[model samples]
Target chain A: MTEFQAGPLSLSFGRKQVLHEVRTEVLRGGTMTALLGPNGSGKSTFLRAVAGVIRANGPIMLDGMNLARMSVQEKARYCAYMPQLLPPPVRMSVVEVVLLSLRLGGNYVGASAAMERVDAVLASLGIMHLADAMMGELSGGQRQMIGLAQALVRSPKLLLLDEPLSALDPRYQFIVMDALKRETVLRNMVTLVVLHDPAVALRQVDSAMMLRTGRVIASGVVEDIVTPEIMAEAYGVRARIERGSDGAAMVSVEGVV
Target chain B: MKERSNTESVQRALLCRRLLIIALLLSGLIAAVLWNLVCGASHLPLDLLLKALFSGPDDHLEGSAGVILWQLRLPMVLMSAVTGLSLGLAGAEMQTVLDNPLASPFTLGLSAASAFGASLAIILGLYIPGLPSEWSIAGNAFLFSIGSAFLLEMVVRLRGASAETVILFGIAMVFAFQAMVSMLQFVASEDSLQDLVFWTMGSVTRADWTKLTLLSSVFSAVMIWSFRDSLPLTALRFGDDRAAGLGVDVRRVRLAALIRISLLAALAVAFSGTIGFVGLVAPHIARRLVGEDHRLYLPAAALSGGIILCLACLAARTLVPGEVLPVGIMTALVGVPFFLGIVLRREKTE
Candidate 1:
């Protein structure tokens, strides 16, 4: 099993700090960790820092490799980050876009192999039918799924997805999360996801790290740390955690505290 | 099995269509170049033109026809083709890296800066002391255009290589150079002003075998290197942040591309003055024809650019018999209409 550890990470924009002493440890071989926070809580910043897309203080170690020390190209080989905002519509096919990702992602897999890999990732995401469709023609949810496929096609060791379910419908949210879970497990990869839906997080993630005001409030197993008290403290709301019909823990917010 | 074969057949059809488009553009280029060679200020009959091109200099019955073919028209025609090719490729790369369809060598004021350099040399008698007077204008244009490019690079480095920064700085450079060129024209002597105006009008007559060789080498080297980075450049179409997420060093790639863009524009303007339309319109034509794949679009843009310039040169010659018109005027005449049509069509579609 591979372990990814980032400890005491600090990030700032100009003089204002966005992430303060944030830390996380994820074990590979199909482990999905959920990063939960309100707006401006540094969830995206943490992911960006770990992806080596942004500069941050402290070390991010992935299988003993320091991600912070690695070059952009080197870091890309180990990790892929799918941002929240979908790319604007371009005149490229979904398949072409995925192929572009694979080529630039530092793995010069041959044409046939690369195409095959792209097809496989698209199919895994249940988007094989949309492969030939132009990106500009896809809906917002579909575009996000293709973006995920682009990130996954690189076969990265660590996948960081910021608000992957933001644009998805309930059905697609479930489907994409399921696909991500399967892909992560089967590939023995580590994935860090930011999910606004607590119910989805409770059902899909193995562990959870909650943050507030650029600091971690709790970090533990998803079911253990996402109690009513933690939710009230983190979100400043009176809340209850109750089991749903699907046997998943759902956060029920009564009112603002 | 049937589905797989269907897909294969569709792919084959697409490939065939792409090849056909490339072939059509290539034939257009060859035809334009040949037409330019045959018909000029002094018309050579087809037979004489062919003979002058293939036969030894000593074998010609008349030395004048040979001189016209070998010395004046051929070099000018080839120079026009190379200039178009460089600007076309540079424009395509600029648009890709900047992620703005309107971006080009001309838009960035590189050509304007080159014109300023040439005007400075012609009007002020500014020449490198050891260099011949003939080489001075070209050398000065190259130096100034490259200087503008470096200025752009410095701005990008200081302010962050955002597309907005590059574009804003480029627009500033353009206005600054245009004003300088105007001031030079204001103070120039009548003969110097005429010379400066002709240089600005853009002509292929400045090219000889030596300049042609230099242009060819630079164009070939840059094109080859750019081809190697085609994959990364393709990824850049998704915008910089997404490109960075995929492992591309966006700043480094943008800088490298800006340098190449400057070099291409400088070389083109150094020998041929400031031909404007090809740099701005060629890439749009290529994108429309071949979609956004840089591998196909880059070369397609180059070929289209060469064809357009050659046709412009041909028109410049034939439009007024025995009186040569500057190739620069023809490109604007030809390209601006095409550009307007594209804009109109895009408006209708979007």
Candidate 2:
């Protein structure tokens, strides 16, 4: 079984401690977890820490291998992180960039199938028509999808994303999250995506990891944790959670939270 | 989709550019040779110029076309090509490596340091005049020119620097080197003043075969050795954090490119005395024509810079009909309007 666990990771930037002792574990072939939090709640910082894009002190282990000890090339084979902001001025065609993300020779996972898998991913995202386009000329949402697709090209065991749905409209939001959720389970990979809203993920993700003030406020099955009381306390406003009569998992926030 | 076509167009343009660059380079060789042999103050026709070229060394027509072709004109054309190509490649690489289009060797204080080195050589050097028709000096001006390049680079990479801050640091280095040169100039002797003025004006009239070959080899080695890193430099354009996520060794690439470009700029400046604008203008033109991919930009910029200098030299030597002007002044004068138009029309500050 694949298990990625981070133990009490701590980091500070200059004078401010952005992420306190935060801890979470994502099980392989099990759950698509969302890092849920309000703005400035250290969710982004924690996601970055999980990806090891910057230096921090803590125990972050993947399949019992200590991430802090692994070389960058070693880590690259199993993990990929998509930052919150992506610049598209690289003068790369979408196809060329797709080629860039494929492992040079082989990988820890399904390296040989990367090109076919990525082509399908582009089609599923409705960007297959843009396969020959430059990333620089795409709409904001299209570019974001391409950026997400590039990170997934290596078929990484762990995928980390930050605020991928913020500026996106509701339709794109549903399309992106659903695709990611479906792909994670199909590939049996662990996904950690940071999202501001959970409306689109009601029927998609299997689990949720909520953060408040740099600490894990809750972590469990999606239905059990995304409650009215907890979310109200988390976002510091009122909210309502009533289960659907048909046994479907859905939560609605009619009030501020 | 618009996206598909834009990318396809960019790709097609690059392929066409590669072919065009090859053609231009092939013609550049023939042009360099032709310009050197013909079109001098004495204006030898091709028939005599060919004879001057085919005949053995130290032989000439009564008009002494050999002295014009073999002794003076040949070396000058060779060095100008070398210097222009080196500066163009260095500037383009620097901007691409830093992911900052505004960065150039000249704006980053390389020229100032080279001028300082040349000034120092002029003011204080042991002169020899009898051993073998000698005008050699004790000054190892070449070595000092490299030292100043290192100093300017170190300042740019100091503890905290964004790309703009780095350019500002280079500007400071220029002012500092300029002050040093001013001090040296104040101490220079009357007899050597004329020599300093001629050297600083950046004329290729004193160019020779020996100097051309040496400069050509060194500059070519620098560009060729650094070519492998061009893609990684493009990968850098995706932003530092994303590149690091892709396992890029960002520090190593930055350091190697900087050191190599430093040598290229210093050597060219030492040879030609701080010719400006080729470093700035050639890369700007290359980006407009070929896009920002360094794998294509570097070689194209080198070719363009060479052709531009060759044409500028032709104009400089022929404009007045009686007196030959320095090539540097023409490059500066011509480059200014083109640069201004690009800058004025450019949509982004980059």
List per-prediction Cα lDDT, in the order shown. 0.82, 0.71
Steric overlap count per candidate: 0, 2
Error of 1 at B253 (Å): 1.5
Give Cα distance to truth, residue B299, candidate 2, Å.
Answer: 1.5
Kindly report the docking quality category of candidate 1: medium
Candidate 1 clash pair list: none
lDDT of 1 by residue, B176-288 (tens): 99889889989988888877777678888767988898889999999998888887788788766678789988878877787788788877887788888798899988877
Number of the top DockQ candidate: 1
Computed on C-alphas against the true complex, the DockQ of each candidate is: 0.62, 0.35
Question: Please, what are the lDDT tens digits per residue for candidate 2 over residues B86-154?
Answer: 888888877766665666777777777766666665566644445311123212344554565556556
Model 2, which residues run further than 4 Å from truth?
A: A12-18, A29-31, A38-41, A103-121, A166-175, A196-204, A211-217, A222-257, B1-33, B44-63, B121-169, B191-200, B345-350
